[model samples]
Target: MTHDPIPARLAALKTTSTPDLKSQWRDLFDTEAPPFNRRYLESRLAYRIQELVYGGLKPETVRRLERLGEELDGGDKRKRGIRADRDRPITGTRLLREWQGVEQIVTVTRDGFEWQGRPYKSLSAIARAITGTRWNGWVFFGLKNHRGRA
Candidate 1:
């Protein structure tokens, strides 16, 4: 019968030193080791070893995961690493408000809000620019009631 070296190699990872693990990480992943803890190294090493023998995740699985991540963070790579707040409207949603007989329209974007071809980090800034006074953007935009109800 043909011999399998994967089990022995995987078992050896448990007793491997930190330095050796880092070296192995470099060799297997073809890059520098991350600044993570020992457990992270061991787990990643174990995964890498198995990946080398059994292959990696299927392409469809990877695509599905990426699609899910995009839905969570609106496909913003900077926000991809962190959990984003869900209170904001989805991208491309238009927020409309009328002030002093003029209609103001703001479009929600992945990064922030857009009003009159200008990008704003917060609704408050847009409200200030429109009124030259401090106002809660959510309240001014009618997104939240003065009593804090949505």
Candidate 2:
């Protein structure tokens, strides 16, 4: 009968402690271990062991997964090939619009927008304050269209 090493290795993982897990991480990854907690090491090592036994993902597949993750997480402004928003104003950008014969400006923040030295929950909130009515913030500032085109 053929032998299975996976169960034994997983059992050993449960028996081993945190310090030993770091050793395992180095043995498996062959690099200086990250300062991650025990559970992280255990899970990652389990995946690695299985990957070694069967096969690992293709390099191109891994790159695609990483790019998808970066797109979902709003990383790297110039990674538009990853489908990052093409025309969205960057964080810390200043947007200006004229309403009622007055020029108003808002500054972009990582989480939200700011206007008149005050942090706002959304651009729509700022638009409501400015126009005294409901307005699509992106349309008001021409960042995107009322129909959601840039």
Best by lDDT: 1
TM-score of each: 0.52, 0.46
Which candidate has the highest TM-score of all?
1
Error of 2 at 146 (Å): 2.2
Candidate 2 regions exceeding 4 Å error are 1-87
**2-118: candidate 2 lDDT, tens digit per residue:** 999888988788778888888878888999778867888888988988898889999999999988978776876565456545576789899999999999999999778899999
Query: On residues 96-139, what C-alpha lDDT tens digit does candidate 1 reach at each position?
Result: 99999999999999999999999999999999999999999999
Alpha carbon deviation, residue 43, candidate 2 (Å): 36
- Model 1: ten consecutive residues of lowest lDDT: 79-88
Give model 2's TM-score versus the native structure. 0.46
- Clashing pairs in model 1, backbone N/Cα/C closer than 3 A: none
